[model samples]
Target: MTTCATELLDKLASRRAIVAVIGLGYVGLPLIRAVAESGLTAIGIDTDPTKIEMLKAGRNYLKHTGGEWIAPLVEAGRLRPTGDFATLAEADVIVICVPTPLTRHMQPDLSYVEATARSIAPHLAPGRLVVLESTTWPGTTTEVLKPILETSGLSCGRDFFVAFSPERADPGNAEYDATGRIPKVIGGDGAEAREAACAFYGLFVERIVPVENAATAEAVKLFENIFRSVNIALVNELKVVYRAMGIDIWQVIEAAKTKPFGFMPFYPGPGLGGHCIPIDPYYLSWKAKEFDVRSQFVELAGEINSAMPRWVVDRLAEALDRSAGTGLSRAHVLVVGIAYKKNVDDTRESPALRLIELLESRGARTSFHDPWAPVIPPTREHAALGGRRSVPLDPATIADYDAVLIVTDHDNVDWSALAEARLVVDTRNRAEREGLAGPRLVKL
Candidate 1:
């Protein structure tokens, strides 16, 4: 091993390394806690002062990451949150876990990742290891990140080490914690960088799978989400096809899943949501164009997934016409769960926002109810719907709506109260499973 690689591995073995995590949002915060839990000092660096203040105040801003998880680390002084990049010099290992959202034109936006690299480049020193945990297109670590860090007049794999490790974090999943149980996929520019990174992550992560190079690690992350997007799109297309044939897609999925060995079920919903599934696949599609190749499967998936909100609204309008003897114009529609998926407060890329806009554009009066998100916060894409708050889910309130649309199936909702609605458009198949069935309950 090289001198720099040897030094980092020694520090990791001794649990005396100062691990710095950049971009302390959903990915970084939990990682910091894991680093602290491994008996190393963890410093969380972010440009957002509001998040730093919240961390200092012992308050958790994310619904899935509880303050209790951070409290013990803060009290023990093992974890420190800061808005300063100069502290990068004190860190023996730095992990980048920033957001990689798509641009307005559906292209890859690496601005945040590039800016983070620039911020840390000046403070980077010899014998330190840097690992990127952000999901991005292939060749990002070696192409985009290496050049920036080399600006510090040090050589990677010699003076410093670099690696790419894609994060597999699932928000609001109680079954998975940062206890090293989830397998981590890592790759580096060279053998030394790869060994050093694997050793560092081995401190907290239980299982580490080492690949050939940084691009492979990057591809691993993209492929994982792309698989989900493609399967979801397939099921979504089948949903429309089955609907035209007078078939219920939910019932079809349940029956197909009975094969047990060959079938894994993917359900159709209002649309894709959250930070990963909806946006990460586009990063691959955009990158493929550089090689003069088209990602046709990914493109088709994007087209079908993106069009789901409109299709849902069309079904809803048809349901309204059939049951309530009215059109979408001026119809009172109650939307359940504004967050992307069930049981989480994250609303980024949530289909419910699009569904709401589509409904309102057709002259439907829309109101939403989510136990997690009481008030819709400002988002970059859906600023107009920011100020709206969740409505009460009582029997009397539900009965007032012309139709109730199930967008997200949060577990805490009073499922029985939905039985009182004049018309119910079920997109999640939740109402039927909950014993809500009648001429009024319409499954999309």
Candidate 2:
């Protein structure tokens, strides 16, 4: 190992390393919490002043963070929150947890990652280890981040170190936390960078898996989300076919899962959502085009998942037509659960927004009710839907809508209350799971 790597490794091993985590959103906050909880001094850096102010006041904006847990850490001075990139100069280790979203053309938009890299470049110092926890296509660490940081006259693996450790953050998942419980997959620019990165992560993370290089580590993240996309696409296709054959896709999946060894069950939803499943597969598909290869499977999966909102809307329209003998033009639909998934406030790439848009485009009046998302926040694609508040889920409110459509199956919702509605379209099979069945119910 080089002297820089050796020094970083020593600082990490002795718990003397000043860890700076950038982009203090879902991934960054949890990571910094884990670092501080592990007895390391963690500096939380973000470009968002609101997040900085919230952290400074010991407030938790995210629901999954277990409520104001950062207060004690902030009081103890173990967690320092700031909005300055210049603070990177004081950090022995820096982790970038910025978003890697797609562009309007569905191609990988690395603007956030690029901007973050540029911000860190000027603060680059020898013996400081930089690790990227952002999910992106292969070679981003070497081809994108390393090149940007080297512009500061510091060479990776020699004067400084660089690594890619993809963020596997599952918000609203109470079972596991990514920071200290989940296994971390790390790949470095070189042997020394890899060693230093692994050693640093090994201090907080439970297990560390070092890969061949930065590109391989990047590929691992893409592969994980792509695997989910492909499997979900299979189930989604099966959902359509089985529905045609008068079969319940959820029942088939539940039975197939009984024979544990081979089949891992991937549930069908109205559409794909969340930061990773809806977005990461496209990164690889876009990257494959550069090598003159077409990721037909990945692209096909994207097409199916993307088309799901329309399919659900069509199903709802058909149900409405059958129940009320009137089309969607005169219908006032109540959409249940606007969040991407169950029990989470995150709405990134949520299909429910598209569902609402498609419904309105088809002349149906739409209102939503999500306990988590009381009011829709501004999103890149669904900015027009922002500021819309969640409607009441009471029986009286359910009685008013032409039909109640369950897009997301949040456990907190009173599923039985839908019996009061004249018509109900269930995309998630939530009604069935909740023992709710009647002539008014339609399962898509």
Candidate 3:
């Protein structure tokens, strides 16, 4: 190991290293918390002034992560949030947790990751270890990030170290919310880089699984999410087939899950949601074409999952026509739960937004009710749906809509109230599970 690498490792071991985490979204916020709680000084950097202002004031913007805990951390000087990129010079270890979204053509979009690298490159100093926690294609760590970062005139393994440690953050999942409990997978540019990363993360994270190189670590994240995308696509396809055969897909899943081995349940819903499962598979598929190989199986899964929102709307339209003698045209439809999944405020790549758009395109008056997301925020694809507020879910509000479509089954939603509605199209099988199933209730 070089002298610079030895010094960095020593700082990390004593928890004296200043850890700077870029981007203050879901993944970054939890990581900074873990670092601060582990007795290390955590510097949070984001371009958004609002996030920095809130953090400085000790107020938490994210609902899943409470506000009360943030005050003490800021008060204790263990955590410092800022919008300045120049602060990277003071950081001994920097972790990039920016967004890794897809382009409109479904290609990998590394703009956020690239921009973050450029922003900090000028401030990057020798002996500082830069780790990327953003999810992207396999070669991103070496091919993309490393080249851009080298613009600082610092040679990668010898001067400044580089590593890839993909963030596995599941927002709204209480069981997995604790960052220290989750096992972190790390891959580095070289042995020294890997050693520096593992040593830093060992301060906070409970377990560290180090891989051979950065590319493998990048593949690990894509594979983990694609596994979910494919399995979900399978159950989603089964939902359609069994629905056509007049068999209840929910009941079939319940019975099939009783087996001790070779059975794990993945439920069908309006469509794929959240950051990873919807986008990461396409990242893999896009990368596969570079090697003259087509990821047809993964691409096929993406197709099935993408089509779910429209299929759910079609079922809702059919239910309205059969039960109320009216179609979606001029019908008042209420969409329950706009957040991608239950109990989370995050609406990134949520299928419910598409369902609302589809309903309105067919001339239905659409409204949504989500306890988590009170008002829809601006999204890249669903910009038109932004600024819309969640409607009340009381009995009076429920009776006004001609048909109630349940896309996301939130635990806080009152499923029993749908019994008074004229029609209930349950995509999540929430109504039946709540003991309110009847002829007017349709399950998809």
RMSD of each: 1.0, 1.1, 1.0
Q: Model 3: per-residue lDDT, tens digit, 152-213? A: 99999999989999988888778988998899999999999999999999998999999999
Query: Per-residue alpha-carbon lDDT of model 2 for 213-235, expressed as tens digits?
Result: 99999999999899999999999
TM values, all candidates: 0.98, 0.98, 0.98
Report lDDT (Cα) of residue 373, candidate 1: 86
Model 1, span 1-444: residue lDDT tens: 787778888888998899999988878888888898889999999889999988887788887777787777888898899998999999999999998988899888999989999998999988998999999999999999999989989998899988999988887788896547789999999998999899899988989999999999999999999999999999999999999999999989989999969789999999999899999998998999999999999989999999999999999999888986878997999999998998888888899999999999999999999998889889778889998999899997788899999999999888889878899898899999899998999898
Off-target runs (Cα >4 Å) in candidate 3 are none
Off by over 4 Å in 1: none
lDDT of 2 at 6: 78
Error of 1 at 107 (Å): 1.2
Question: What overall lDDT, based on C-alpha atoms, would model 1 receive against the true structure?
Answer: 0.91
Pairs of residues at least 3 apart in sequence or in different chains that clash in candidate 2: none
Residue-level lDDT for 376 in candidate 2: 92
The lDDT of each candidate is 0.91, 0.88, 0.90
